[model samples]
Target: MAKARLMVVEDEAITAEDIRSSLEGMGYDVVAVAATGEEALRIAEKLKPDLVLMDIVLKGGHSGIATAGELRRRFSVPAVYLTAYADPATLAQAKLAEPLGFLTKPFNEADLRASVEMALYKAGAEAERQELIRKLQEALDKVKVLSGLIPICASCKQVRNDKGFWQSVENYITEHSEADFTHGICPACAKKLYPEYFDQLYGKGSGGTPE
Candidate 1:
């Protein structure tokens, strides 16, 4: 199995190196390390890594939270924040980005492992869900984007097959699409064909003639 590709977005050089080393040791790939929020976003767009390890604060005009949000919005990548501050205010700010996981500073190897594992698992699940939705939408679009005007027999209300044969509308539609039909009678048709039944239920002259 391929190792999960991870990008470390930390401004502190030493900390970034440590993070990269730890991740590599854990059998996860450290694809690229970015020291600024701008650089992080650029590399993320280019590499499309599976997950990002982000620091809440970065050395740039933008914060890691903002970078992570844009990454998710544009590329659908999930981020795990590793920060020293756990203050309610800071966490609340990070919450807006909807990070997949968070690990506090001074974390042990186990904490790192747990955070990375959980984030990767959730990312995998989300990716699977997105793929399924895309496939379903593609199938629905194919059905909806039916070919150009269909030739039909106006009198019989039947359709002309591509093979130059006449076929019922239901059969033609069924053959050309993922659709099924259920028969039902409209009020007009019911009144016209079943006049006795219609009169028994609703007195004569209660409804207009069928078309």
Candidate 2:
């Protein structure tokens, strides 16, 4: 499997460097380090990193939650929030972003590794689901295209097969295609083709037989 690309968002220089070093040691690719939410958004859009390590409190116009929400809306990127303060009020706000995981400050290498692994797993599952849905939509789109633009002879009412040969519409329809046909005669055709039978059946000009 390919290594997961990560973006670290932290305002503090020491903390950001530590996280980057630990991520690299864990076999992850640290694409970029951002000090502000605005900068993170810009880099994340360009890099399309697999996961974002977000700092809940950053020096920027947007908060971590707001940035994660925007990224999710724009690119469907998954975020993992980090904060030293795990107070309920702060966590309540962080939960709004629907982060994959949360890591408190002063975390060891093991904690970072576990959090990053879970985030990558969650992101991978979501990516697979979206890809599946896209493929299904593509299949449906192809079906719709085949359903339209069918070439047929309007006058003879014969369907033109893929080989450009015009065959009886009934036989053409009954080919390997999914459609099934039941043979029937309409009132107009019955009257024109078998007028005597029509008269006998409907009492139309029955008094005068075919002379």
Candidate 3:
């Protein structure tokens, strides 16, 4: 199997080198290393790495969270944050970006490997789920088209189906679709079908009065 491609974004030179070494040791292919958020975004778009290891605090105005958000929203790239700070406020902000994982700084090789593997697996599972839902919706749409349908009669409130069978409107609709029927009166239908009863309950000028 091919190695999972990764892009590392860290401004600290020593930290970046250490992360690159650790990721390579874990059998991931480090496609590119970027010290700034802008460079990270550019490399991510062009190279299309399988995952991004981003440091939350960066040199430029665009922080790791901002870059990760852009990558996810625009290119659909999965990202895991590698940060020194894990304060509640920072974590809350990070949650808004929807990172696959967050690893605090000074992490060992085991933490690095585990976080990366879990992030990739989560991303893969989500993609599979979306594809399955899409296929199910397509199948349902085909079923609707294959089933015979009928138009309702305006005067009698009945349906004339393709088989030349005339049925009650509700019965015809319920047969062909997933709709659950609940018997209730719409204001206009109530007024038209039971005019005397409507007038008795609510008086002449009420909006529910028959047309």
Q: Which structure among the candidates has the greatest TM-score?
A: 3
**TM per candidate:** 0.69, 0.67, 0.70
lDDT per prediction? 0.90, 0.86, 0.89
TM-score of 3: 0.70
lDDT of 3 at 172: 76
lDDT of 2 at 121: 86
Candidate 1: which pairs clash?
none
| lDDT score, candidate 1, position 132 | 100
lDDT string for model 3 (1-211, tens) is 9999999999999999999999998889999999999999889889999899999999998999999999999899989999999999999999888999999988998999999999999998998998999999998875643254457788998988778888997777677776768887866777678877877755776554444
lDDT (Cα, tens digit) per residue for candidate 2, span 136-195? 998876552135565888898887877899888667756735576777777667778887
Best by lDDT: 1
For candidate 1, which ten residues in a row score worst on lDDT? 202-211
Candidate 2, which segments miss by more than 4 Å at Cα?
Answer: 137-211
Candidate 2 TM-score to native: 0.67
